[model samples]
Target: VELILIDESLHLQNGIEAILTMVEENPEILDDYHFVENIRQSIIDAVELELNYLKTKFGGTTIFGVSYGELERYMKYIADRRLIELGFNPQFGIDQNPLKFLQKEDVKKLTNFFEVTPTEYTNF
Candidate 1:
């Protein structure tokens, strides 16, 4: 089964704006690879290209382990969770997603809920 993973850091609006700014200023050679090889941010900046992923290319998809692909990125945000065992700082973008609270075995059970498929929906 094939799976698709979405990286919201670059997939979100904030990351798009950064790329547009670079192209607007250098209208000449985005053709070359050096134009936007660097970026920095405290929280989320969409792609946060500073991070590395050999599997993921310009088109899309990133790996987050075998079962992780089942979880949605923003299904549960920090929203100010008040637990210390999770150890996720409030400032961190993920801020203790439910996955963090789950033990390894518990996470494995998640596979029962998701499987890869060629298409999700035909039309609305």
Candidate 2:
């Protein structure tokens, strides 16, 4: 039940490429693979690193709750500002507003969702 809230500005390609290079050089994996497989593996590794960083280092997942005015601030903080800026107010749906339900009780529910709920696949 882990949550991931990307600020929309995070640089993904560079991190993905870096991780792919590392994984490709490792001698323990299969000796041969296709370009698409490499790219897919790179994306998976990059996502895992990002999630682990948010969880272990920050002690929680990110929840982008910026107000309308503060949206620009987060947009600038991300690596691909141009792309993120183009997608301003990127609401997936009316019900997907995290800030709208940021009441204390709602926050407690969200936080507890991570603690009490078991993910479909738990490493432990």
Write down the TM-score of every candidate.
Answer: 0.23, 0.26
User: What are the runs in model 1 whose C-alpha is more than 4 Å off?
Assistant: 1-11, 36-67, 72-124
Worst 10 residues of 1 by lDDT: 1-10
Global lDDT of each candidate: 0.35, 0.38
Candidate that scores best on lDDT = 2
For candidate 2, what is the lDDT?
A: 0.38
TM-score of 1: 0.23
Residues 38-96 of candidate 1: C-alpha lDDT, one tens digit per residue: 32222324323322332243224544452323233322242223112222244334554
Clashing residue pairs in candidate 1 (N, C-alpha, C atoms within 3 angstroms): 9-46, 9-47, 10-46, 10-47
